[model samples]
Target: MDERFEIFLVATPGLEAPLAAEAAALGWQPVVGPGGVTITGGWADVWRANLWLRGATRVLVRVGSFRALHLAQLDKRARKFPWATVLRRDVPVRVETTCKASRIYHAGAATQRIERAIAEELGAPLAPDAALVVKVRIEDDLVTISLDTTGESLHKRGHKEAVAKAPMRETMAAMFLREMGFDGSQPVLDPMCGSGTFVIEAAEIAAGLAPGRSRSFGFQQLASFDAAAWETMRTAAAPRPAPAQFFGSDRDAGAIRMSLANAERAGVAGLTRFDCRAIGDLQRPDGPPGIVIVNPPYGARIGNKGPLFGLHAAMGAVFRERLQGWRMGIVTSEGGLAKATGLPLESGPVVAHGGLKVRLWQTGMV
Candidate 1:
């Protein structure tokens, strides 16, 4: 608390250990939680966490947290806190609040009070579409306010300008890879790499790349932001390459092209090879037994479940026939699609993502 650090990493449940591992790899002492990890440090830690944490959805910097008995005390303390340190007077910001076991349980009222205080007292503008968002959580009698230092979620790596239908976010993909026990040295294969997210994220990890290296962060605009310190951190945290071992394939030629473009923009094009081939054609390159992670199309909503069922059935057939000893991770929203694979899968954890409760069904062949 003395360091004024208020950052925590939110991830899929059962992934706290992997997220903690990624944080600790970057010299961050991360404490595991039920669904995430919390770390504390200085203002520079805030910037570095946003830039380097691959497994977190977003980094929330704790601005203020105090015990509040009533709405009056909440408003008073909120006003006294230095909002200017985190918010830019020129850029607009939105206040979002969630209330629980507290006297000020009305969320709208609390949000309005904080919004008015920041605007009238701190001279910050209010915009409905403000990229910078402040989240206030009231639990028990303590009110904790955190700034969403990552404007867009860290998944928006600014590389994949094109998005496929039901395209997975980069952050979610990274978290899934970590959940599958992916280490950087081993080869990674995405048989149905629709947009090449898994392979590209793996390549980035293998190359020691930071996820947010190509994008700008909200913390860069904060009043307390130090330009020289951030530059030094970026220079030091940039990724280095390993062996060429990332591979991805999709049946669609368009997806292959888009994936290639995304890889080029991400500067990991050399690390991954995107192929326009059916799953039957996927072959493991020369390496130790590695991962075969697939986010195959679920016949849930977009397509005909019957035909998509056939697709999942085909994927299962290919996996059973070809991948004898490789570990497999099959992600799907529909349990039936996952079951169709017919592989001996260990029940992985359930995670909320993209309007569906997706589960990662795995077969540990390695």
Candidate 2:
């Protein structure tokens, strides 16, 4: 395989900007485009992106591409491509196909051709439930092949076994924290901290911990993987102490228990605390003020709107009274419900989370 190829960092719709910013800040000149931020590098870049990028859903290496205007041409090209350079003959892989503005538009037929090419020619077994996936995109009559270098979604994080209803994903929470101007130098508190995702993400950022430290990635199974070099890169940086503590609170005792357990599993229990308390009972901790980010129950997700307005209004009052001088971010499905909080909040772009369209409402200080 060539030492250089394209690495695509997949982002959810409307979130490609922040992910690009993060990639650029991490020293890669990222090209912002639809589907993701793309960069050109080698296998090490693939490994590093999976380890360092918290906002990407999965990192894909665009290995090769070709032009095929018909099904027979695609079958011929697929059989001749150099899959053995990156894919192992022993590892099993699954094939998925998508066609856009292409003459050869039978996606199922295309999938079959590639599957047979790899299975029969490359000597790799094809399985329906394989961990590795070879994604084929036929766009503008050009066949683009990419390997899913990230097996599971990056949000898994290999920790946080417990999850609450309508839970915020770790990837979204991390990007939201960055959007709220969090730099890991101040405290972070989540009032409705379900499963402690926001708090754990904040604490991890503060401690300079890599998001993929506790997990293995699909890139490790690729033929080009360099174990010694990856190990050296992974262990070169040690985690440092957080500048300030992180806190989470919830009305449900079970939620608090879940938060504590999740934090412990994430190795941030020493820098975080979970309390079983209502929003009304929340008081500022004795430290420098920071960001207050919360993902409260959305009316659409819960099938109840009557109580939510009141809940938001009450929560707004609590923030006004107790959380002054702290910047606030609230994630909710309805703008009306978020405005009911009555903070000086401006709306961010709509993000798709847990099958619901949600936005992040932010304020200067509260």
Candidate 3:
């Protein structure tokens, strides 16, 4: 058994640093790579990462790699590779291949070759929509094989059933929170909290709940998975009490209801509060200074960008006047809208969100 393998923590492109920071905080020596973070660990580490990592979109295990300049050589190597060690004979797998600057440039042909190899050698059924995925990359004639340990994106934490329009993904929200310097001790507030993503995530982090606790991972279907070990690891961490309460307020009553329901399902209802109120009605809660993070409407998905200037200006005015000593993190698509707030916000990196590029604008204590 290969105890040590290369682990890839797939992160959203612009947020790789926060994901790497998260991996490092979890005691993994993370090498910042393009599009993700890389670590070297065993099957146990793979399991733990799928269970504990909040910022990673998916966890991929690099099983092995070899140089194959031609499709025939790739097929031979693929058939001889130790597939039984990682894949189960009973579970079906889907093979996805990509080729860049390589002699075997036809990805479809390469995928078919690998699929035939797996079926003949390992006797595993190949399905188009299989839960398990075998990812192959042929770049510069270097073939690398990896397994997607996460069936669904980690953003689907299995608790948030109801979502508002243009909702921020939980994975992106986690990275944004990390970028905001949230340490899980102070309170968090999302004024335009659609479905309570940021508040609930913060509450969960403060409560020491694993993001993957409510979900099942693709690694559970692998041959190397130990049910008893996984159960032990999942139940090892006891939930902690949050030091402060998290808050979410939205003008839509339906959104508030959804937020409340989602929070209850996530086991953070006691630590979070959701209210139905507009941005102008947002009042400072009774608590010590904390971070206020909001993913407001950016006009691309919600409405016209014209009237949003007044809305941003109103929010900026309220935060600047009332929320003294509270730090603010605003995620928006337009830099002008972020500037309309009239707050001294230093722009962060532009990240991809729902096909549109967005940036996190942060301000010091207001």
Candidate 4:
């Protein structure tokens, strides 16, 4: 219960650098770690991060850690630990535990012990499906406790209820946009946009909108939460007019409708446009050159990979013929698919998306 606690910003693997960069840009000096970036901050910092950071999948506040040789010691320390400072008695909590290289190797037993300690001392109800979660990790006999301040993964965004098959997570889309050096100053286009994730995200970023503005956070239920202060923080950023338009096109009319609905719910419909068109029929918008980002169907998700070559080639032909001076970011699992584009693409880091390892293939002004 220190004034400033360690906050871990979890990122999708292979996307740590961009997330770290974002944290630094937000005035936090984060130390990059295995699965996330760690920074020292208080409860208010946690709230702000959950509200502002688009790349973070979840925010975990490291409450405390202690050396526990056995479950008895763990239970005693957990009972004494200042749970009142973080966990509210009125809210329910779920305790999850992991034991590694320790005598207390039974994760279930350790979870029960911590659960008993919290219920007995803090008077908080324990439930199997509670929004608040206490994560305990016992590694090398060191018990580290953390709280998941992001209830339903940050990707939910509380707006994009309509999703297409093989839809991209908002968190990953944000990071991918960042990777393309999208500062929201220029236009963005998704030729094969499914559910319009990239286009909607770009429009929102251009409007200077907070990703979590439409959502509620788990931190609001914590004991240290200050309602007035949180309200001030969440509404601090005034939405601005986008510099340019964002566009999305899909062959499926259903996908186009879903994109429009999703954009409306995200409050970025004014800055975005969606159409039903095949890649070959896509025409560049009337504006200066911008970035073209698309998450096209891959072999794993959609139909056979054999015929995709022609589709990719057609996409490349359209981009080369119509989208000159426009940069490109293509997310696909197969290198042949990207190569078939014939756009002189250079591969970036490989990312894990929906159980398939995909890479961002980038091309300088096509």
Q: Pick the candidate with the highest lDDT.
A: 3
Q: List the candidate numbers ranked by TM-score, top first.
A: 3, 2, 4, 1
lDDT of residue 35 for candidate 1: 70
Local distance difference test, candidate 1: 0.82
Query: What RMSD value applies to candidate 1?
Result: 2.3
Please tell me which model should have the higher lDDT, number 1 or number 4. 4
lDDT of 2 at 301: 82
What TM-score fits each model? Answer: 0.91, 0.98, 0.98, 0.98
Stretches of candidate 2 off by over 4 Å are none
lDDT per prediction?
0.82, 0.91, 0.93, 0.91
Q: What is the lDDT of residue 120 in candidate 4?
A: 97
TM-score of 4: 0.98
Q: Which residue pairs show backbone clashes in model 4? A: none
- lDDT for each residue of candidate 1 in 1-366, tens digit (9 for 90 to 100): 136675788876656777888899789788998778899887878887888888787888887788877788878888887887677788788989999988889989888888988997789999888888889898897889888888877778877786666887787788788878898977898988888899999999889887888889877767777788788888895567587888889889999998999999988998889889997787766777788888887765566778777788778788777767788898888888888778877766677776678888888883
Q: Using lDDT as the measure, name the better of candidate 3 and candidate 4.
A: 3
lDDT of 3 by residue, 242-301 (tens): 765799999999999999999999999999999999988988999798999999877786
In model 2, pairs of residues that clash are 324-366
The C-alpha stretches of model 3 lying farther than 4 A from their native spots are: none
Give the clash total for candidate 2.
1
By summed lDDT, the worst window of 10 consecutive residues in model 3 runs over 295-304
